[model samples]
Target: MESLIAALTLVVVGYIAGSVKIINEGNEGIVERLGQYRRSLKPGLNFVIPVFDTVLVETTREQVLDTDPQQAITRDNVPLTVDAVMYWKILDVQKAYYGVEDLESALTNLVVTALRGEIGQMDLRETVSGRNKINQALLHQLDEATESWGVKIMRVEVQEIAPSKTMLESLELERAAESKRKAAMSETESMVESIQRISRALQGQPNSQAVLQYLVAQKYVEANLKLSESDNSKIIFMDPKALTETIGELISTDQAELGNGNGNNL
Candidate 1:
């Protein structure tokens, strides 16, 4: 009789232990009875029918998912490597649990797809510089797509956007060429301006022709010295007299125009 009583007591204790569940804060539990849809369990102590109900607990707090680098191409056909992070949380544990087979995996694939699609619509420059726009676009797109999955996509961040090594080299070369072109243009403008100022200063002077010839000879020598200093430079020989004649012609035309204007004013 005593052995039977102790056995029954042990069975009762086991049943009570199995029925009582303590869920931690920031978490929720889903209870399914007989492998069918059942009510969810809130945080704190909960009770369930022993041996008939099974409980699955998950955190309701926010989660972070860091994706691996994904390869994508821009609208301009520039291949790029991209990666991102996502902040999310389970809003409906039941939906999150049942609406998707693998919630985390699904979210990752979705983010990657969206990333590639968004990047595909922009060029390389836009993709590199428009990170905030990309982030916002991804957030909105992911949030809408994940609504049914019972997950809230709080934020999306693009960590890196790197072009291919070949592309980077090409960009560097292009930039260097552009810089050289601009520098040449600036030098040409400066030379023209200096010539105009010198012409105005020598205008109407009695020895203007001598001054112009001397100035042209000095500039020609200076240019030759600079070209000689550069090992890679190809020195082009020109007649200094031709340059002097050109400047003389310009000065004469300007003086003529000035005299005509003065007569008109009178």
Candidate 2:
């Protein structure tokens, strides 16, 4: 009799212990009684009926979901691939357990659907440049959708937006062509301004020969300096005094012509 009593007591103790659950920190347990949700067990030592009560769900403190790159068409009719990641946390254990059949699958589908919708409304350039705006939009949409499911969307981040290599090359070539066109325009404008200035200077000159001789002398001096500094330079012997006297004579003749015209007018 003593042996039978001891065995029965041990069985009872084992059953009770198995029914009692200890939820770890940063975790929650959902209890179901007779196939129906009874209550959620918070982190600590808790007890339930041995045979009728069961743990319906267990949820983590936090969760992360990385979405694969998805190909989408933009509003401007450009195709692009976008990858993203999401952070979520379970807020209500009961809702998490019963609100959706599979949380991960639901979340994945929701993310893809939201991304496609947002991308479809934006052009490729806008999608790439306005990534933060897109992320915020996705997070808001996801949070609203997952509210009933007890999953709170903490953040959504766009990881990457990849354009085709051919598109990238085409963009680069267009930019290069634009830069070349601008450079050519600038050079042409500078040449036109130089010609205008030279024409104005020649128009007012009373002695064209004297001005031309002066310019020639200046150029000759510059060339002589450069040639003297170079290796294997030729020695061109030009009389500097004769050059100055010729310039003086040309200036005097121009002054005489001007004086004669003034006297006739008077």
Best by lDDT: 1
Per-candidate Cα RMSD to the true structure, in Å, reads: 3.8, 11.5
Instruction: Tell me the tens digit of each residue's lDDT in model 2 across 1-266.
Output: 99999999999999988878998888898888889888889888999888889875476667899999898888987777889899999998888888999999999999999998999999987998999999999999999999999889999998988776677788887897788568747754764454344434564577665565666577567656865885645658579888767556655555566668779999
Residue ranges of candidate 1 with Cα displaced over 4 Å = 196-266
Looking at model 1, residue 243 earns an lDDT score of 79
lDDT of each: 0.89, 0.81
Query: Per-residue alpha-carbon lDDT of model 1 for 1-266, expressed as tens digits?
Result: 99999999999999999999999999999998999868999999999998899999999999999999999999999999999999999999999999999999999999999999999999998998999999999999999999998999999999999998898999997997788668757865776567667767777778876876677667767867876896655677777678767777866776777789889999
Give candidate 2's whole-model lDDT.
0.81
**Which pairs of residues collide in model 1?**
none
Clashes of each: 0, 0
